[model samples]
Target: ASHGTVHPDNEDWTCFEQSASLDIKSFFGFESTVEKIAMKQYTSNIKKGKEIIEYYLKQLEEEGITFVPRWTPPVACKSESSTSHTRRPVSPAINIPDSATKEGLNNKEILNTSSSPSEPTAGTPDDKLDADYIKRYLGDLTPMQESCLIRLRQWLQETHKGKIPKDEHILRFLRARDFNIDKAREILCQSLTWRKQHQVDYILDTWNPPQVLQDYYAGGWHHHDKDGRPLYVLRLGQMDTKGLVRALGEEALLRYVLSINEEGLRRCEENTKVFGRPISSWTCLVDLEGLNMRHLWRPGVKALLRIIEVVEANYPETLGRLLILRAPRVFPVLWTLVSPFIDDNTRKKFLIYAGNDYQGPGGLLDYIDKEIIPDFLGGECMCEVPEGGLVPKSLYRTAEELENEDIKLWTETIYQSASVFKGAPHEVLIQIVDASSVITWDFDVCKGDIVFNIFHSKRAPQPPKKDSLGAHSITSPGGNNVQLIDKVWQLGRDYSMVESPLICKEGESVQGSHVTRWPGFYILQWKFHSMPACATTNLPRVDDVLASLQVSSHKCKVMYYTEVIGSEDFRGSMTSLESSHSGFSQLSAATTSSSQSHSSSMISR
Candidate 1:
């Protein structure tokens, strides 16, 4: 081959290396003027070899170089009546009538007029349309809609600092608010503030649902819908709402629901990539086959309403559609309770079916494909949703206990709670190997009255076994109440009183410490305190009599935390040493006066 000559083998050109620049003179051996023209053309088509030669030949003709050009004849754009001219065949997908009738000409005219790529080619007047629907980053937005998005983004940048969300996310809020910039900005900012306050944005990473919820909560993500939206199946009918409420309370359940929504948002993003389309929202299939009166428990209803309120406000427009399947007669009652909290736009997306009506046409099949439909719904695919049953009565918690849990969740504190029943006191056993070490405690008697006592035992009590309900609830009716002192052990022989018993009334807070006098196992106990039969017999005041007849006299609730610190560290702090001896020196006015001097036990703030 000649120097700088191009060669083609098997229809592939041996072109210049991409790293090399296009040198027109060296490659084509042209004069300065022609080379300049060729260089200008090569700048755009540097990678094209044959196109450059064709372009150079045309340029050569203009520069007084004569060459016969090989050109194909142009096709005619006439109708079937033109006999002399030939036309290219049209694609079969396009509709074109062979007969030269007036209707055919009219149809062609209509097609030509609407040939712009922007016109909708399908659907009828009854179909609901979203004018702002975007695909592959291309949105068909009106000028006003585009302007609103730009202005809203600018406003957010100016008014707020930190990180801004993606434009698509902002547009979701805009679409949610009908592109009303003011309303969208207000709600988006409020949602951002709420997310920060609750740390909801980090919920998927931070919140871990309890094992009970994971094992019993009846919901999970399934495959994508026909439209590429993520699908989530919730078997609400089988779930034991009352049981979950009593076991985990409302806050934990709310946290778990928030994590679900967060995960749904993430799956939408993932499915968008996998399906090669814009998927900003998800589809939810809710099965209510076994829904009954039990699902309408008051606490559970309240929790559901709260969840709806939060999700509606923060995750607006995130649900593309909701398919309610096998809606029982009881569903109307629930809908009446929860519908008011649901947004009007979201309500429009709901497609509910009664009984086995979902199995018919325009049911789950309309949104979900036949193959991925769950087996429980008569589809081939198997669903991994939990078969939620009644939560164990053994795991039920009292109102006061649940309240304490809510406080701990909100405050993010390190406090453990316990229930104290009449015969079975809640006791924590601490093994102290070194004398003079300090055992400190802070406790609040949240409900009813309780007796607090510290006992020292030479022998350790059997360690409590880990149970599903948590804590030792072997002997008590309420959860978290555990008894460590053996029934056969005598008070004087097996364990001696290390601190005088302190009676803590409801709503009282106590902070105390005890210095170890011996190397032994120490037990801190909270016992349900009641007036003796003799004491309550002749109560002088009516209030006192009624107080003695309180309904919760047999049960008590306490939230407490305890720590054992070595004396070496305790000696360095004047405050701790002072706090340690404060209880021994004097008791609070709320506590009964004791005759014994227990120097080892102390109470302070």
Candidate 2:
């Protein structure tokens, strides 16, 4: 806290807000009343500052002091079929479509156009990247965001050693983290690692969803929605989840979904060209016509949860809308089972329609143009989407086989295992080089109750000299050994928590994330449920979990994996995205180091 600041004559106005000293009750006469109203009206003007600037610009145009630039393709005209925005969102006060065809805006014409604009304009690109050009072509973004994005991209180009993601791809992460370069970079790095590890980038070329998925997955892309966003229709209720999993297996299923997302990204690019506008995301219409108990297979549900995790982490803000129509009474049960894993931004897009409600104003009609609504939904359009068929049990491997394979694959990953005990917590130390990088963890509470927390320290915590004892390490009978956790950590003085404590139940696998706001050492701690009185002494070691959950009286067990991601990429050249916008805002709070735990504990994926 800085104190003893000096103030010059006019500095009083700069240092102390006049609003803080105003008193409405001190009106001594009619002059005071007038002053009160004047102040009220004056304050109101502050709210209209942006509008006033827009109005002033309009006035400037009227007065012939300023003139707007005209946008044109490098060629006198485009190819007959090229989709281009006729109206642009450059004025900041008005949203004009660059061009509109009955077909829709896909946001691709600007980037994919064969002829450069000599000078970029709204919905157009140029050979050279410029901030104003980006503002007019892509979405509106704050200068800070532009800088953060550029820095992140530059860092990636210089340091990352693998394939580089596109600027649009990087921007999505930046936007997801409210343009916090460190946070966004961390997220991107992790996703890139996951992609590389899973060979996700090649999915579009290598993945082949078996005939079973092609014939019975019951999902396909249709025409664009009214907003020019590409629309996808899914007969979720009619589709067989168990069948797909059996046919493809979890990894294959995950890979297939990744391919769909990859396809979606490509489609979104193509759609931008077709729509002649900025179409960053697609719309999903899910028809839950026949969802039931059979769809609730535990293995299938687990697979779905894993899929959600992969999608949420890699593809943020890709789904513009999720319109769930014709949901049944059992929908809640299914929603409850999988909703916990859904990101809040994605969850907000879900609009559930029960019975025939989708035909009304706040339902499908609100998103989809009525004329294009599929025939099954009581509309005239013929939906080519498949009517799914059932899959035979022969496609499924035995449950025991799947379980064995799952455990085998899980053990092969670079994850750590530890036993938790009452009072003692399992803690992992992560050191971050860049502030705002993300720290992520995936863990399963195999037994007992546990609490999870993450704290940050400016300096690495050293074992206390006052204890007069050396550090402790133990080896287990199974040849697995781990160090004992230091139990007496002071919360604020030594290390302040960056994330709130998370309470996890037994048998649950939890995945969570946090963005580091500053470069420092972070501690992720998992503690067993302990008696309040036994909280401060020596806690149990990681070997206890390896020894046997049964050996400890307060037995608790956890299998965990953690990683740190920085904000950079693996590529040789950096292509700065240049184009246009309406507005970009700073997020109001920290990214919260969360991909998000749950909308609630059990129901949101």
Best by lDDT: 1
Q: Model 2, 180-279: lDDT tens per residue?
A: 5678889899999988898888887876777777788888888879898889898888887767776667877777678878888888777666655556
What lDDT does the true structure give each of the candidates? 0.64, 0.60
TM-score computed on alpha carbons, candidate 1? 0.47
C-alpha RMSD values across all candidates: 24.2, 20.1
Q: In every candidate, how many clashes are there?
A: 1, 50
Looking at model 2, report the run of 10 residues with the lowest lDDT sum. Answer: 570-579
TM-score of 2: 0.49
| lDDT tens readout by residue for model 1, 1-605 | 11221211101111121212334445455566665565456433433543454465457557864433322237754443222211111111112222212232322232233222354333322111122123242245543455466567657766886556655677789999877677999999998888888988788877779988998899999988999888999999988886787788888899998898889878876776676556789999999988865565444667788889988888898999888888654444456547668887887787777677776767677778999999889899999988887777677676578666653353235467787766668899999987766676767677888999999999988765455223224333444766788777999999999888998888665665666777889999998786766354564555644543432346688887777766444433222121111221122211112333223221211
